[model samples]
Target: MPSQPTLAFNRDHIHPGDRLCVAISGGADSVALLLAIHAANTAPRESLGVGLSAAHVHHGIRPDTESDADLAFVEDLCIQFDIPLHIHRADIPARASQARETLEEAARTVRYDFFRSLIASGHADTILTAHTLDDQAETVLLKLLRGAWTEGLAAIHPIIHINTPNQRPGKILRPLLQTRRTEIEAYLHALNQPWRDDSTNADTTYTRNRVRHELLPQLRTFNPSIDQTLANLAELAREEESRWQAELSRVLPQLLLPGKPVRGGGRSVSTAPGHSSLSIEIERLRPLDPALRRRILRAAARQLGSRLSFDETSRLLALCGFLTLPTVAARTGASLHLANGLRADRSPREIRLYREKQSANPE
Candidate 1:
C-alpha cells in the first residue's frame, strides 16, 4: 500500500482548497479515499491544503436495512472525522418506474443528479468519486466485449465535468484512479476502518460482476498481468484521444459550413447552409482520413440526435466508396442506419449532414 502522505499529496493536486465533497458509498474504496483525504488535510503538509466533506446518496434500491447500513456507516465516519456530512435519499423505485429504466440506470442517474444538486447548493466546486485502477480495467474490458471504439476504450477519466442542464457545473475528480483496490483495502485495514459491502456487487447478474468473478479469473490463468495490460491500454488510448480531439477542434471549423456555432445550447456542433445544408455535405465526406473521418461523423451524429456503434462507424467508412458516383447516397443493405440523416450518396463533396430535431419530451 502507498504511504498515506503520498496519497494525500495526490489528492491535494486534484483538490487544492479545503473545499471539496467526497462521495462515499460506505464501500472500502470510498471509505479509504475519504480517510486518506481527511488525514492529508489535517496532516502537517504545508504544501498540501484542503478541507473535505462526506456526501452520501441513498439510492433506496436495495432493502431498507441495507440502505440504512450504508448511510449509517458514512454518517459515523463523518462524525468521527468531525467533517460535515450530506445525506440525500432518492426514491429509486419511483424513478425507475417513471423512466421505465432498470434499477442500475435509475440509481446511477439519481445519485449523480443529487450530487449535482449538492454542487448547485454551493456544497463544493468539485466532487470526488472513488474509482480505482481496477474499476478502470473493468470498464475497459466491458467496452471491449461490446466492440467499443478507440474513445470508448479510453476508460473512465480521472476528472469529468458534469454538464446536465439546470444543474451547477461541477467536476468529478478521481484521486484514486491510479490506486489499486488491494491497496485501498490494505489502507482501510491499517486505519481500522469498517465499510459496508454491497451484496449487489457480488451478484453475477451484472456484466461487471460476472467479468470480475468469472472472466478475469479465467484470463488470469494465461496472463497474471491482465489488469495491468488493460490499464496500460486505457492510458495509451486516453493520450491518443486527447491529441486527436485537439487536432479535430482545429480542423473542424474550416471543414464546416460558415457561421456555424461549434458548441452550446444542447448542440455539440452547428454549421450554416452553403450550396447544400451542412448536414448534406457531411454525407459527401471522402477525402478525410478514414480514422478521423469516422470520429467526426460520430460526433456529428451525436450532435444530431443519434449514437453510432462501432459497427455503424465501420459501415459509414465503407459508405465513403459511394462518393465516386454522381449521387451521394450509400446504403448498408441492412436496417442499420448511419447518423446525420445519411442514406446513399455517390459524391464526397455533395453529401451533407443534418441535425435531427430533438423531441419536446424525449423519453
Candidate 2:
C-alpha cells in the first residue's frame, strides 16, 4: 500500500522470527492489518522472518446481527492465507456486572485478557492490533473532554505494555498507527477483499462514536488538519510521558519511609511499608518539586491497587503541601478519607496513606 516497511508496523516492537498475534474483528482496519502483515511475510526484506497469527473476539452482545458469518470470514481468511486463528466467545454482560465496568469496557478487558493468555501460553511474542491515526485522534479528544492530565493526552501508544498479573507480561504493537482509516480501506480495496461492517460502529450513542461522527466533523471546519495536529500532540505527549515515567520510577522509592516497628512478636516482622502504604515523611517529601511529589504519592496509591484519578490526584496533592506544616495538623491528627479505602493522615511528623482509617478533621 504505502511501502513494505510502513505497511506493517514499527519493527522495533517485533524482532525478526518473532511470532505476532494480530487481533482481528472482521472489520476493515483489522482486515487491512492482517493483509498487510501477510504481505510483509511474503516479501523479502531484512529482519522479515516474522510469523503471523490471528484472533477474533466475539463480544456476546447484539447477537441478532453478530451471527452473520463474521467468524466464518475470519476463519476462511486465515485458512486461505495459512495463518493460525483463535476464536473466543465472552460473556460481556456478566463480566461487566462482576467488574463494575460498562459492556464496552468489559468487552475490551475480555479481549485483552485472552490476548495476554496467548503470550503466557507461548503462542506469540507480541500482540498487534489495528489502531489507526484516527483512533488516536478520537482517544486524545475523548481524554481531553474528561478533564485529562498530561499522561491522559498520551493516547494510543505504538508499543503498549501489557501487564496481566500472574501471567508473563507482554507488549502490544500497533503497526497502522501512522496510517489513516481511509488508507486502510483503500489497502483492502486494492486487494478486492471484503470485510464485515459491524452495525455498532455507526451507533452514535457511544461517546467515541459521537466524537467520531459529530465532534470531529465540527472540529474539522476550524482546522482541516485537526487529526494530524491531534496525532502530533499525542506523539509529543508519549515522548514526554516516557521520560516522566522513568523519572517517577526512580524518585518514588527514595522518598518512602518505613513504617514504625511492631511492639512484640517472636520473630519481629519489619514494618517497612513499601510504596503500597502511600506514606512518607512530611519533612522528607515537602522539599521536592510539586510535580515530582505528586507523582510519588500517585505511585503509592497505585501500588495499593487503586489508581487515583486526575481529580483524586489533585486532591491528595493538596494534603502533601498543607499537611507538611503544623497549622494544618493543629491538635489531634488530621486526615482526609478518600475513595478506594485510602486515608491520608498527618501526625505533624509524616503524611500517611493507609486503608480502613477514619478521617479526623482536627479543626
Q: Pick the candidate with the highest lDDT.
A: 2
Q: Backbone clashes per model, in order?
A: 23, 1
C-alpha TM-scores of all predictions: 0.82, 0.85
Question: lDDT tens digits, residues 16-39, model 2?
Answer: 788899999999999889887787
Q: What is each predicted model's overall lDDT from 0 to 1? A: 0.72, 0.78
Badly placed stretches (over 4 Å) of model 1 are: 1-9, 163-169, 258-277, 280-286, 322-349, 355-363
Off by over 4 Å in 2: 1-8, 44-47, 163-169, 260-276, 322-332, 357-363
Q: In candidate 2, what residue range of length 10 has the lowest lDDT sum?
A: 265-274
Q: Which candidate comes out best when scored by TM-score?
A: 2
**Model 2 clash tally?**
1
Worst 10 residues of 1 by lDDT: 271-280
